[model samples]
Target: MKNLLTILLLTFCVSVSAQTTRKYSNEFMNIGVDAAALGMSNAVTAFSHDVNSGYWNPAGLVHIEDKQLALMHSSYFANIANYDYAAFAMPIDNNSAIGISLIRFAVDDILNTTQLIDDDGNINYDRISLFSTADYGVTFSYARKLPFEGLNYGINAKVIRRVIGDFANSWGFGLDAAIQFETRNEWKFGIMARDITTTFNSWAIDEEEFATVQDAVEGQNQELPETTELTIPKLQFGIAKKFIYRYDFSILTEVDLNIRFEENNDLISTSIASITPSFGFEVGYIDMIYLRGGVGNFQNELQLDNSEKVSFQPSIGIGFKYNCIQVDYAFTDIGDQSVALYSNVFSLKIDFSCFR
Candidate 1:
């Protein structure tokens, strides 16, 4: 008990002392995940014997009964990564359990365009022709859950790495700790602090070194610049409440105070202070038929542009559970400057312990 309290206090201290983002390059958390995307915020309150507990909330693992494992993957527009996550957990003596999670974030193939300029003193011609790509972050997480009375507490730590073509490559770590205060009678509360590492990694400008070379349509000989490390912060800390009625229908809501570190804000501020609240409701009975809907704000900036902010994409989803197997699906439209992202996604989650 003493050690648990110490760990919780330390996690909060890390978040308070971490340095935030200094410039461009924003970290995102809304890209993928079935439950949260579809708006099951109501059900996310408890640690059900399901796999998605890796993202929406990990502390729920403390409630699992039998041993379980699951993998979730999705194919998105332009071949961009929708989500690839895996997790497993087993009970430890009844009130405590341990689990592990792995999540990979990826982007679609991109064209790396370089302009070919012809300065003939009379007419200058410019044509962009190149191929490039951008992607970042690979995470491995470890979590442990312990129960106290009717409540549960959990902790997760993730190691992250980011890579974007020749622009930059940064590696860092993150930590999230949460407490699930609940009662079988009716109400529940949840609190979590994410990205406590404020990771700093090295980045090299391969293009900057090449920018000075004599437009020598013939001199491709100079080497690129050496990389330097930069530390950036991307953090989210939130609290939520859930009300389960008749032990079936539920309503869940969360209010998050988010702080982003970037070069600048194309929509708000380099260090913007914002509040994001999400809501979800579920309709079903006997765990056989289910339907859910949810909607929240999605960032519309690239690295740091504070000029535009639009919100209006409510999500909808449905699933079926039979005995020890279940299947899920959701539809969400996510986008940016390059193109409008339209996604009709499906998820296949198997919770073999479906009441086992």
Candidate 2:
């Protein structure tokens, strides 16, 4: 089973190398950051207002009141892959903010079986080794409030790094732009454009290392892989409103439309684009304790009986905040509503003012 898994993974790597522009490229970055946002099915575009906003909608960073730091960790695929995120944001002035964020997703200790069978045709377990595949993203964000009240704009400069052990590696860069607007009645609207400049990745494969795999596969992987990969643009539009009940209780609700310029099995699919709608809400008590829930990633799935059915992912979470420190937890499905096992996500946030 281990050797089979290695072969399958390597085949996938080779296949990916054959494509110059692929859908879902650098998808690890789209898995999202903060647990609070995940709990809400990533519907926080218009509602994000802290360091985590660096990933959700950078324009929301203008709402940060102080120096803030955020961290999150999650595991997927029965703990075979680990995802981590960290971010920091500070007010550049009363109307502007700057932030930075980092994300990493990795599958570690994968068996390297290219040499499992020695030259003498002996099945030698001792020849097997281990390696890892990892993807990393770093983003620098800036947001400024417009002269018009309640309007803000932001931009992100993103750098991406991917590695498949010592066999392959790539470097990528992209740009993002976002805008947020709030009404006097507290309604919020946001738009985020990812990879607005068309992210590009250039891969460098080690031919020497690949030769062993080529020999193992027999008649496959005879040629070097494609060196370039491109990721097209995607958009997210969101609207939200908060209702304050009595004096200490509140509820915030949000809806978002995620748009991809491709024909896919999304909830609303067309020849030019596809749209996936998401809904989320948060309930809070005394501004300290919170409960969150959402549903998103609607897709059409073919059942065993060859019937098409609509499926969605649901997530729930809880949060607590005291002084300048906050912690949150969420239970979410990472596998597009198909996997039975769910992932648990946890995140922390701190305000630097607490130290002063």
lDDT of each: 0.50, 0.90
- The candidate scoring highest on lDDT is 2
Q: Estimated TM-score per prediction?
A: 0.64, 0.94
Q: lDDT by residue for model 2 over 159-214, one digit each (tens)?
A: 99998887889999999999999999999999999999889988888888877666
Task: Write the residue-wise lDDT of candidate 1 on 215-330 in tens digits.
Answer: 23243333433343334444444455555669766544544433454434323444444344445555555667777776554344433554555443466677776776666766
Candidate 1 off by > 4 Å: 1-30, 35-37, 41-49, 75-82, 108-147, 164-168, 204-272, 298-310, 334-340, 352-356
Q: Give the count of colliding residue pairs in each prediction.
A: 21, 0
Best by TM-score: 2
Stretches of model 2 off by over 4 angstroms after superposition: 1-15, 18-20, 122-126, 334-336
Cα displacement (Å) at residue 27, model 1:
2.4
